[model samples]
Every structure is written in C-alpha cells, then in structure tokens.
Target: MNYFIFGGSGFIGTHLINYLKENKAGSKIYNLDIIENTHNGKSIFINCDVKSEINLNIPVSENDIIFNFAAIHVTPGHPDYDYFETNIKGAENITAFAEKFNVKKILFTSSIAPYGASEEMKMETTTPMPNTPYGISKLVAEKTHMIWQAKKNQQRQLTILRPGVVFGKGENGNFTRLYWSIKRHRFFYPGRKDTIKASIYVKELVRFMVFRIENKNIDIEIFNCTYEPAFTIEEISNSMMEITGMQRKIYKIPAGILKIAAGIIGAFGGKSIGIHPDRVKKLMISTNVSGKKMKTSGYNFHYTFDQALDDWFKDNNKEYLS
Candidate 1:
C-alpha cells in the first residue's frame, strides 16, 4: 500500500513519516508538500502546494491511503483571509485529488479550536462553536472530508482527529515556550493557574491515527486526541518542574494587565519578544478536551504527560534543559 501525506514536511507530518518508516516499513511513501523534505530523505518529496490543484504523475491505486495535515494553523500569525484561503482550499483540493485517484481512506488532523476556548470538557459529540478563522476553517475542512466519504459510504473511510496542543521533538509551540520560560526562571501563570490546556504527544497521536484507520469498523469516526481529565496550567507547570528538575517561582498576573502590556509591546515592534496579546488571551482560556473514546477503544497510550516530556527532552539531545 502507498501512503500519500500532504504537508509532510511539517512537525506532525515529519513525526508521522518517521513512525511509518519504522513500523510500516516497505510501504511506498510519498510526501507532497510545498516545503523541502528534510527528514533524511525517507520519503519521496513532491514540490506541491495543497491550496491549488494537486497533480501527481506517479501511479496510485484505490487502496492507497491519504493523510491531509495541510493548514495555516497559527492564530494571530496570519491575516484572517490567509487561514481560509489555505485551510479550506487545501481541504477541497486534497479531497478532490483523492476522489480523482479513487483513494478510499483519508486521515485528517484537525484541531480542538473548533470547540472554542472553553473550560468545559469537550468530546467528539460536542457541537463545534468555532470563534476564530482558523477554527472555523478547520471545521469546514472536516466537513469537506466528510462529504467525500459520504459519496462512497461503503467503500470510503475517513478518520478525523481533533488534537489539542500536540508537543514532541521539533514542536516549537506552547510546550517549547513553557520549557524555555521555566529554564530561564521567567515562567509565570497568566491570569489564573486553573485554565485547562489539553495536550498530547506527537508520537502517541500518530500511533493512534494508525490504530484507528487499521481497526475502524465505521465509515467515518471523529475522535478527540487528548488526555482524559486534562491537566491544568498549574499541574502542567509543576510536572515540568518535577521532570526537568527545574524550579522557579511562578507568579500569577491579572489577565487584563497582561493583555494591555502585550498590546503595547506588539505595537512598538516587540514581535520577536514572543509576547502577543492573542497569545496572552490564549493562556487565560481553557481547552478541556476528552480522550475517553480512544481509551475505551482498547488503544493504549504509551506516554503520560511527564513521560512524554522526558522523551521529548531526550529526543532533543537534552538541549531543552541545557
């Protein structure tokens, strides 16, 4: 079987490619991305962007699988139109290409942003109430994939994963920022410490993706990829300290003051400082998602939050602590 991964040069895609190479060896793998494939040339790279039509001259079979991870996901980083232009258009193009090739299985990596910034636990059954352009576009993209599956109900299979804050090697996201803040003794709670930040390890996410597609009995399944009883900001911070043996006094600042400060800093060309108003707002909100579905499906999570952090540190050659 052949694996076609769009956006395969990205953080999650890179990890997925590595996982497939180690586990599903001998399978033909093709990485279709606009960026260069730098994962030691494990998969065939195609210089293709998903925002436009996907044209592949290589041979493909109906039994082949397609993984779509293409999206402009960073909030406050891009203009509103950019998110829709890329994410929605990318989904449309990807599904169209799949239909053209008669590819029956598609696995999409969506985000928990569709649930909005809520402290309430979100499950697959929760109604999507997206608040941002990125969230709305992802929700629409999910529908695009669903529409494709519905056209060939019996023959097509679609698995949509809504993961929150996925962190691991090469992820220069929230976890990385937190690590740096604590290591530099500059970590602090923004507004409050009880805000839930549902997260998952990239390795576990890829494993679950494979497990769901291989063992699914339904035509389309939507699963929330996060730890059940999601960790609070304080809990996560404390865990990081314990795991890394790094201790620092964390102070809680009022959300309003931080927002004003971030605005002033951003207005005066403090972008490189990595303190934006939007990011500050994000810290104050909660993304309390649930992963009970994956657990009840008999899939075992190989890494706890702490273990995942430890593994990520090792993967980075322990440079995070250094």
Candidate 2:
C-alpha cells in the first residue's frame, strides 16, 4: 500500500517510519512535512508545510492511506493562534488533499487534550471541555476530519486516534525529562506520587495504528489510544529505577512550595528548567484516560508500560547515560 504521512519528521512520525521499514509494511511511503529530512532514506520526503496551501505532489491511488500527524502541540511553546492556524488548517488541507485523490483511508493522530485537564478517568465518549488553546484546536481538527468523512459517505474510511502521552526512543517530552532527572539523581515528587499519567509507547502506538489500517472498515471510527492500567508517577519512577539500575532519593516536597517555585520560575521564563507553573500544576492532576475501545477490539497490546520502557532502555541507555 502507498502511505503518505504529514509531520513525518516529528517524534511519533519518525517512529512510524521506522516501524514500517522494519516490518516492510509499505511499497512506497511519502513523507510530507516542513522539517528537513529526518527519515533513514526509506521514505521519499516532500518538504511541504501543512499550514500553507500547496500540492502534496503525491501520486494518489485507491486504498492509499493518508496519516495526519502534523500539529503545533507543545504546550506553552507557540502562541495560541499558531495552534489553530497549524492544527485546524493542517487538517483542512489534508482532508482536501485526500478528497482530491479519493484516498481510501485517513488516519488522524489527535490528542487527549480535548477532554481538558482531568483528575477523573476520561472515556472516549467524554464530553470534551477543552480548557487550553491547544485542546480546543485539537478538538476542532477532529471535527474537520469527520466533516470530510461525511462527504465521502460510505466510500471512505477514517480512524481518529486520541492518544495520551506518547513516549519512546528519541521522544523529548515529560517522560524523557523524568528519565533525565532520575539519571542525574535529582528526581522528586512535588506532593503525592499517585497522580495518574496516561501514556502509550510510540512503537506500540504506531503498531495499533497500522493494525487499524490493515483491518480498515468503511466507517468513521474513533478510539482512545493508550495502554491499559493507567500508571502513576510513582509507578513509572519505580519502573525507571528498576530498568536503569539507578537509585535516587525520592523527595516529597510540599506542593505549596513547588507551586510558588513554579510561579516564580515561569514568571522569569524558566521553561528551560522544565518548571513552568502551568506544567507543574498539570503534573498534580491525573489524566486517567481509558482505551477500552482498543482493548475490546480484540487486539492485544505488544508492550505494557514496563515492556515498552525495557525496549527503550535497551536501545537508548548508552546514549541516555552520556
């Protein structure tokens, strides 16, 4: 099958490319993104910006898959307007491009942000109350894809995956920062250790996406994509220590002190320290998202959180220590 990926240079996209090559999943893969080439010469790269109007230049055919992973998703990184401009506009253009070629399937990697910051377990059917510009933009992007699918009627298939925090090799996100802190013996919990962090391994996430693609059914479908048994920060830290063989004194600082520190650091523009007040606040909240749809679909997960971390450490521990 011919595959086209938008934002194919980003973390998850890079992993997907590697997965396809390792599994020999596609005959021809076209990677579309604004970033310069990051793939291993396995994909044909087209330096196209999804926010801009341009031809994707991909030879379209029936049963072709268009995977949209493009978005300005880093919280507190870009301005609010940029999120809507890139995410919403990117979805708009991708759907239009798919329509132009009559692409058979379009798989979208959305986020759990649409449900907003939650302390309770969130389901796929939860009423989205997006509280941030990023969340609002992602929710709108999902709607845009649905609109395109509606136009296709029974002729096209769509899979919208709202994934939780995706982490693995080469992923520089919250989870990675945690690893760094543990490695340096500076790991600490601001208050409690039971804050649920919903997450999925990048490889496992791509595998699930590919599974859905190969078993495509003609319908507009959506699924919450994350590993089962939502893990707490304590659980993750314990796993990290076990895998990396690193022991650090886990400090339990008062939440109030950390909150004040976060505010002062954020006011001074200290995101470099990974201590924005907003982010610190979010860390206290549990994003216990449920992926029951994926589980009930009869597809067993390849890696639990522990297994995923083991694979990541096996591949990256040498570089991680340096």
Candidate 3:
C-alpha cells in the first residue's frame, strides 16, 4: 500500500516516515510538504502546499492511507490568520485529495490546544472551548475532517489524534528548552511546582497512531494522545535531574514578577534572552488532559516518561551534558 503524508518533513512526520520504512518495508511513501525533506531522502518528496491545490501525478490506491500532519502549530509565533489559513484550509485540501484518489483512510494530528488551558483533566468527550487562534483553527480543522467522514460514513475511516506537548528526538520545543535551562542552572519553578503539563514522546505517539489504524474496528476514532495522569512541573524537573545527573537546587520565582520581566524584555527585543510574556503566562496554566480512551483501547505504551527522556538523550548524542 502507498502512504501519502502531508508535512512529513516535520519532527513528528520525520519519525513517522522512519517508522514506516522500518516496519512496512515494501510500501511506497510519498511526502508532500512545503518544506524540503531534509531527514529522509529515500521517501518520494513532492513540493506542495496544503493550502493550495495538491496536484500530484503519483499513483494512489483505494487501500492507501493519507496522514495529515501539516499545520502552523507554534503558539505566540504566527499571526492569528496564518493558523486558520494553513490548518483549516490544509484539512479541506487534504480531504479533497483523499476523495479524489478514493483513499479509504486518513489520520489527522490535531492538538490538545483545542481543549484550551484548564486545570480540569480534559477527556475526548469533553466539550472543546478553544481560545487561541491555533486552538480555534485546530478545532475547526477537526470538524472539516469529520465532515468528510460523515459523507462516506461506512466506506471511509478517519482517526483524529489530539496530542499534547509532544517531545522526543528532533523536538526543540518546550522540553528541549527546559533541558537547556536546567543544564545551564538557570531554570526555576514559576510560582508553583504543581502545574500539570500533559506530554507524550513522539515515537510513542506515532506508535499509537499506527496501532489505532491497524487494529481499528470502527469507522471513526478520536483519541487524546497523552500520557495518563500527566506530569507536574516538579516531577518532570526531578526526573530530568535524575536521568541526566544534572542535579541543581531548584528555585521558585514569582509568576507576577516573571510576567513583568518578560513583558519588558519582549518590548525591548528580549526574545534572545529566551523569555516572552506569552511563554511566561503559559507556565502558569495547566494542560491537564486524560488519555483514558487510548489506554482503555488496550494499546500498551512502549515507553514511560523517564524512558523516553533516556532514549531522547541517546538520540541527541547525549547532548544533555553539553
């Protein structure tokens, strides 16, 4: 079977492609993305933007699957309209392409951001109350894919995965920044240590996605992709310290003060200092999400939080020491 992956050059996409190459040896994988495929050269790379017409001459079969990982996902990074333009339009175009090719299955990577910041543990059945542009766009995108599935209810399969702060090798986002901060001895708890941050390793995420697709008995499945009983700030920091042997006396800084400092720095081009008002505000919020649906589905996780960190350290050539 062929695999058409949108945004396959990204961190998650690169890992997914590698996994498919290793597991599904004979399958032809086509990566369609605006960015160049710098990680996997063996996969067929086609320069295409999801927001525009996805015109490809490659052969596709009814059994082939489409994976949509394309989106402008970084928070506090892009204009509000950029999120809707890429995420919403990208979903429309991808489903259109799937319909055109008579593809039976599609796996879309949505975000837990659609659930918004809340101390309450968000479940798949919970009503989404997205506040940010990125969150709103992701929620809308989910509906767009659902609309496609509803049209061909019996014949088509759609799996929408709403993952939390995914981290692993090639993830230079939240976890990486935290690693660097702790390594440099500049890290400090912002106000409280109990702020919950729902996270999943990228490898585990792709593994679960594949598992759901291969073992699926239903036409549509929407699962929240996150580790159960999510980690708190203190627990995460302690784990990093133990795994890397980078023990340092953790400190607490007032969230109010940090917010003020971040605001001043942002106003005076302080992004180089690695603190922004939005980022500071994020520290105070909890993304408490529940992964009960995935767990109850009987898919055992391949890695625990600590194990994932160890593997990531190995993949990065043990850069945790540097």
The regions of model 3 sitting more than 4 angstroms off are: none
Q: Write the per-residue lDDT of candidate 3 for residues 144-214, one digit (tens) a residue.
A: 99999989898889999999889987777888888888888877788999999989999999999888887
TM-score of each: 0.97, 0.95, 0.97
RMSD of each: 1.4, 1.6, 1.4
Candidate 1 regions off by >4 Å? 216-218
lDDT against the true structure, per candidate, is: 0.88, 0.86, 0.88
Our model 1 lands, by Cα RMSD against the true structure, at 1.4
lDDT of 2 by residue, 1-322 (tens): 7889899988888888888888865478888998866676878899999987758554679778889999999997789999999999999999998888888799999999999987878898889989999999999999999999899778888899999888888788888888887877656687988999888888889999999978748888888887777788999899877877777778888888888987987789777877688888888888889978888887888887888888888887545621
Candidate 3 has its poorest 10 consecutive residues by lDDT at 313-322
List of clashing residue pairs for candidate 1: none
